[model samples]
Target: MWVPAKFRSKVLAEPVRRPQLIEHSSDKNKNKNLETRPQQHPILSAQQHSISQELHGKKPAVFKMPVDYSKWDALELSDDSDVEVHPNVDKRSFIRAKQNQIHQQRFERKNKIETYKYERVVNDGLLKRINALLAALESHSADADKRSPDELMFMAIMETAGDSPNEAPPPPPAGVHTQEKEQPTYSKMMAALVDQVKAKVDEDKPENRFAAYVEDVKSHKAKVEDLQRQLLEELDSLEKEEGRKITSENIHTGFDSSHVTKGKAEDKSTGEAKKSTQKAQTVEVLNPQALGKPLLTKKSDGQQSSGADADADEPMGGDDDDEDEVEASELGKKFASIKAGDYRTCLEFISQHPEVVAEKETDGLLVLAFNSAIDGAYELARQCVHQALLLQYCRALGRDGVRMFFKRITTPGHQAQKVFFDDVNSTFARIKSRAKEIEKQRAQEEAEGTGGVEQIQLHAVDPNTTINIQIPPENSSDPAEIKAKELFNAFPPGLQRALESGSLDEVNKVLGKMSVEEAEEIVAQLSEGGMLSVEEQIIDATTEEGQKALKEFEEQEKAAQQEQAAEQAALSKYSDDPE
Candidate 1:
C-alpha cells in the first residue's frame, strides 16, 4: 500500500486472486481514461488487498496515517520554573544561597585538614587504596562500555554473520566476484572471462629469483651482526658505570671512633676517686653531633648539694648561663607556671624574660620544654607523675617513651608547645626522610640490577670478557684436609667425632643452636630412612621373619625323624625275613 510511484506498476502486475471490480462510466459515453493515480476509493483499497494476498501470501496490512506535526497547542501549560514563579524568590537569590553553602563546606574541609595530625601518613594510605581502586574502576568502566547500546549492537551484527572470524576477510577486487545472483545469466561472458585469464597466465611465465634473494639476505645478516656488536658494547659500558655507583654508595665513613678512646681515658682517671663514694648513675643522652651515649650522671641519694656542688656543675654552663640568684628564682617560677599547662601566662613571661626558655637544662632538652613534657603541661595527660628528678629521668624515658610523649601531645597553646613540638619532631623527621631515601636507593639498585655482594653467581658469562671467579686464592694443597679442619673449627667434636669427650650438656647446647627448619629436616630424613628401616626390622621379627626361621628349623627336625623311622623299618624287615 505504501510502495513508491516507480514501484507501483511492478507491484500491480502480479494479480493472483480475484476481487470485486468497479465499472467506471465517463460523460458522453466516450472512453474516458485508463491512467490510474492515487485515489482514496473503495475499489483502490480492494485492489491493494488483492495484490497483498497474491504477492506476499498474507492479509493486507492496514497502514495508519501520520499525525499532523508542527501544530502548536495554544492552551498548553509551561513547565519552566521561572514562569509564574514565587513573588519573593528569584534566580539570583537561589544562586547566592548555593554559593554560600559551597563556601561553608570548603571552610569546614580546610579546618578538618589543619586540625587532623598524622595527615601525611593517612594520605599515603589513601593514595595506595586509590591507586588500586582506580585500576579496578578502569576495568569496570571498560565492561560498561562493552555492555552499552552501541557496543551491544556491534556485537549482534558480528554474531549475525555466521562463522565470522575475529578479523574480517578483505573484499574481492572490483571485477572479481562482481556478478550478483539476481543478474541475468551470461554464458558467453563467463566463457570470455575464462579464456582471457588463460591467455594472461600463459603470456607471463614465472621465473627463478633465488640468487637475488640470497644477496639481500646476506646484506641483512651483516647489518644485524653490526647491531649486535653495538648492543654488547653499550651493555658493558652501562654495567661499568652501575658498578662504580654501587661501590660509591656502599662505602661507609664518619664513625665516632674518638668517643671510645675518650671513654677509656676517662675510666682510667676516675678509677681511684669515684671508688671512695657511691658510684654515679650513668644515663644515655643525645649529644650535639646526634650521637646517643652514656654522658649524663646523677648524684647519690644521700648527697647534699652545697655551694661547692653548684660550682662543680657551673663549669659545664656557657656565657648564656650567667643568671644571678634573683633572676634564676624569677625564671624558675615562670617555668613552673608553664609546666602547670598555663601556656598563655608563660608565653607572656618569656617575652619579658627570655632566658627561661633559652638556658639548657642538665637533661639536654630545652629547660622549659623538658618541664612541659615531664610535668604534664598540656591537655593530653590525665595524671601528673614524675619518674625521676636527675639524670636517670632522661634514661628512664627511653626512645619509645619519648615517642609516646610526642604522640600524646594535645593543643599547642600559643608558641611554647609549638616550639617544643618542632624541636622533637625535627629529629624524627630527619630520620624518616633518610629512611625513605635509602628505600628509594635500594629500589633503583634492584631495577638497575646493580648492588654489592660477597659473591656473584654467573649463569652464563661472555666468552670475550675475562672474569675472576675465584674468591679466596687457592692457598692449601689438600682441599679435603682443609675442609675437615674448617668443620672441626666450626663445631666442637661431639658424639659423631669423639664420643668419649662428648657431654650431654654440650650436645644439648649444639642442638639448641639448630634452627627449627634444620631440626625438622633432620627428623624427616631419619624417619624416612634409618628410623623406618629399624622399625621395619622390629615389625618383621614380631610378625613374619622370626616365624619363618622357626618354621625352617622345625621342618629340618621333622625330616631327620622321618629318615630315621624309614631306616629302622627297612632293617626290621630284613631281620624278620632272615634271608
Candidate 2:
C-alpha cells in the first residue's frame, strides 16, 4: 500500500529526536556558564542534509524516525490491494466479455432460425405430397361417376395439415359442411364448388345496374332493326329501278308475234323436186322456228308467168335469209347484255365487301358464305376427298375392287396418294376428338348459361374457319361412313339443319321440335344436294315464268284495244246524230 501525498506532511510532522554533539573549537567556547549554542548550519540545509544522510544510510539516526516526503515527490500512491496502476482500463477484457455475450445471442438466434427452417421444410413437404395425392385422386375421379371430390380434397388438406408441424389445420369456410368420411368423385367436387359459388353469389349484392342493362339491350335491338330496314329498302329501290328500265325498253321491241310468219317461203321448183327424189326419212328438215308444214309452192297456170318471174328472182331471195341471221345475232347480243348486267350486279355486291369475297379468290364464292373464315381450307379439302371417295366406292362394283383401288391409292410414289391412309385416319381421329371436345365445351358453356348455336354460325358462314372435324376418305380401308356418323352424332340436329339450309328460321323450328342430332342430319342433306342444287338454281333463275305472265298481260291489252275500236265504230255508224 502507498500513502497519499496529502498525508505525507502529517507523517513528517511526527515527534522525532535529533542527536546532540559537543565540539571544542580552537577559538570558540569562551565561557563555561554561557550555554553553548549548538554549532548549527542553516536550518533548512541541515534538514535537507539529514534527509539525504538518512536516505544514503550515513546518519546514526533512530529506526523510528519520520520519513520526510519533501524530497520524495516522484512516486505515485494507491490504497486498495486489488487496484493496480493500469495505463487505461483493461478494454481487451471488456471487449472479450461483450463478444462472448454477442456470440451467445447469435447461437440462440441460429437455433431459432434453424428450427423455423426445419418446420417450414417439413410443412412444405407434407403440403406437396398432399397436393400430388389430391391431383392423382382428381385424375381418377374424373372418370368416376359414382363419387365426388370435395370430401377427398378436404380430407387430404386436413390430413396433410395435421401431419405438418408449422401449420394448424383449417376448418371449412363458414356455411360449408364436410361430407361423411368417404372418397369423393370429380363430379361431386364440381357440384360442391358450384354450390359454393352460388352461395357466394347470393351473399353479394349485384353491382350492375338493371336500368343500364335494359337500356343497352334496347339500344342494341334498335340498331339491329335499323340496319335490317335500311338493307331491305336498298334492295327494293334497286329492284324498282331495274323493273322500270326493263318495262320502258320492252314497249318498242319488235319481236315477231307468230312463229308461222317467221318461216322462210319455199320455191315452187324446190317443191316439185322434193316430190320427185326426196326420201321421207331423209327429208331436209325446216328450221326449228318454222312449223312442220311444207314450204309455200307457186300457183298452177294463171300465176305461172308470175311464178317464173318469182323463180327468176328466187336467187336474190337469199338476201332475205340474211335478215333472219341478223335478227338472231341481235337476240344473242341482247342476251349477252342481260347476262353482263346481272354479273355486274353480283360483282358490285362482292366488291363493296372485298374481305367477304376474299375466299372466292381461292375456292371461289361457291365454297364459302362469309369473308371472315379463311382458315377452313384443310377441312374443306378433307370433305372433298371424302365425298369423292364415297361416290367412287359406291360405283366400284365390288368390295375387292374397292379395296384394290384403295391399296393402289396408298402405294408409294403415287402422285395422288401423297396423303397416306394413315394420315387420313389420323385426321379423322383428330376430327373425332375435336368434335368430342367441342361437344364437351358446349355442354360446359350451357351449364354455365353462356352457350348457344354460335359455333354453328362459324361453320355455316365462314369457309375459312377450320373445322378440326374430319372423316376418312372413301377409298380408305377405314369405315368413313361410320366415322362420319359418329362425328355427326355429336352435334345437335337443330344445328345440323341450320347448316344444311340457308334458313335460320327453319333451323329454329327444327330445334323446337327435334334434338340437335336430328337437325344435323337434315343439314347433311344440304351437303349432298351440292352440284344438283347448283344446276337447279341456274335454271330456276332464267326460266320463263315472267315471260308467260307478260304474254297474258299483252293478250289482255290487245283484247281491250279491239273492244275500244269496235265501240268507236258503233258510235260513228249507229249513235243518234248530235242534231
Candidate 3:
C-alpha cells in the first residue's frame, strides 16, 4: 500500500522487530560455533556492543512523544478517504452543488448589504440636498423673490457639492446614445431636484413646501438608517456563526478553541449585565407614585370608576383640612412644574391625577394632552387608551370645555398643531354624531312607551353649571300632559330655560350647542309659536335658501326707500303751495 506523504515520515520512523529462533545445542558446541562464526568487523562489533549495553545494562533508550494528526481533520483535501458519497451519484456533482449553494448564499448576503448601502447613500444625499435648499430659503426668505430660480438651484448645488463630490451625472435623454457622457463637476441630479422644488413652490405654493420636503427626506433617511442598522446586525450574526463553526472544526482539528469559547462566554455575560443595568435605569426613571397607583379604582359593586368620575362626585370647595388635600396639592405642583410642549409628561401626569382634567380651567393643558395621545405617531393600542382617557376627561369638562379646546387648538401655529386639531375636530364631530344616534334611539324608545326613569345630566349655558334632570317613565294617564312633556324634552334643557327666561344672550349661548340645521328648525318653531319676534332674518349667501331670502330682503328694502322718498317729495310740494 502506498502511504500518503503526510504519514510516510511516521511509518519510516518506527522500525519493525522480528523474533529470532535459537538452535537447541550443547553449551560447549554453542560456544565453539560462536567462536567460529566469524571475526566480526570492528564497527559492527562496536554497534552490537552498544545495543547490548542498551538492552542489558542500566542505560535507557531515548523516548519520543507521539505526533498528533488531529489538526488535519478540518482540512477538506481532495485526497481525503473518509468523505462518503452515494454510490449512484457522482462525487464531483455533489461537491459542485455544495459550492454553488455556498456561492448563492454569499451572493444573496452581499447583494442585501449592497442594497442597504446604496439606499443609505441615496437617502443621505437627498437629506443633504434638502437641508441645503431649506437653509437657502430661510436665509433669503425676505429676498427670495429677488433671487432667480436658476441662482437658487446653483446655490443648492454648490452647498451639496462637498458631500457628494463624485455624484453621477443625469442620464442622457431618450433616443440619444453616446459612448461616454461629459462628467460635470457639480451634480446634475441635485440641480434637477432643486428645479422641481422651485416649480412646486410656483405651481402649488404649499405653505413652506421646502420645509416639508426636508422632513420627507429626513424620514426616508431614518428608514435607510434602520435598514443599514439591521444589515449590520445580520452581518454580525453571520460573523458569530462563522466563528462558532470555526471553533467547532478546531475542536476536531487539534487547534486551541479555549480563547473563542472564553470570548463568547464573556460577551454573553456582559450583555446580560448591560440588560440588567438598563432595566434598573428604566425603573429609576419611572415615578412610583404615578405607576404604582391605578388610574381607575374598583367600586363596591365591582365596577371600576375613573379618577375624573370620582373627582366629579366630590363636592367642590371642600375643607382645606381634607385628608387628600396634601396629595392633590402635590399633584398640582407637579403639573405646574411640567414644561410647556412636553406633552408626553403632561399626559402621564394627567392620567395619574385626573382631578386636573376635571378643573374648570386647564383647557390648554387638556388640549395638549389630547394632542399627545391622538397624534397618530405612537402605538395604536396605547394611543387608543390615551384617546379614551382624554375623551372621558372632555366629557367631564362638558361642552364649554370642549369648545375652549377647539378654539385653543384652532389658533394658527405649527403645521403639526393644525393636523392634531383636525384629528380632534373630526373626533368631536364623530362623537356628536354618535350622541345624535343615541338621542334618536332614546326617542324611539320613548315613542314605544319603553322609556326608563334615567337621570340625565345636561350641560347648561354656563361652564360651571350643569342640570341633572330625572327623565320620568312613560306612565302619564293624560295624553296632553304627555305631549307637552315630549315637546319640553325635545328642546335641550339649556334652550328650554333660555326661551322661558326670554334672554337673547342665553338663547344664543344654547344655540351654540346645536348644529346649523337644528338651530334653524328651532328658531322657526319659536317664531311660529309667536315666542320669538323677528324683524329681519340674516341669511348666508352660500346656501340657495339664504340667497333667495337675501334677494327678497334687498328688494323689500329698496321699495321701502322709494316709498319714503315719495312721501318726502309730497310733503315738500304741500309746503311750497302754502296750504
Best candidate according to TM-score: 3
Q: What is the TM-score of each candidate against the true structure?
A: 0.14, 0.12, 0.22
| Per-residue accuracy of model 2 over 32-117 as CA lDDT, tens digit each | 53343333334447766667557555564455868797644432222213443456767556556655774565455444444434
Using lDDT as the measure, what is the rank order of every candidate, best first? 3, 2, 1
Between candidates 2 and 3, name the one with more favorable lDDT.
3
Q: How good is model 2 by TM-score?
A: 0.12
lDDT of 3 by residue, 15-48 (tens): 6642233545757665665544333334456556
lDDT computed for candidate 2: 0.40
Indicate which candidate wins on lDDT: 3
Better of 1 and 2 by lDDT: 2
Overall lDDT per candidate, in order of appearance: 0.37, 0.40, 0.50
- Over 4 Å off in model 2, which ranges? 1-93, 140-579
- Residue 519 local lDDT, model 3: 54
CA lDDT, candidate 1, residue 74: 22
Model 3 bad stretches (over 4 Å): 1-88, 107-130, 141-186, 192-210, 216-227, 230-579
Q: Is 1 or 2 the stronger prediction by TM-score?
A: 1
At residue 153, candidate 3 shows an lDDT of: 47
lDDT of 1 by residue, 434-542 (tens): 5456668877988998953222112113222222211112356666545433323222222122212334343333334333333344334323322212111222346
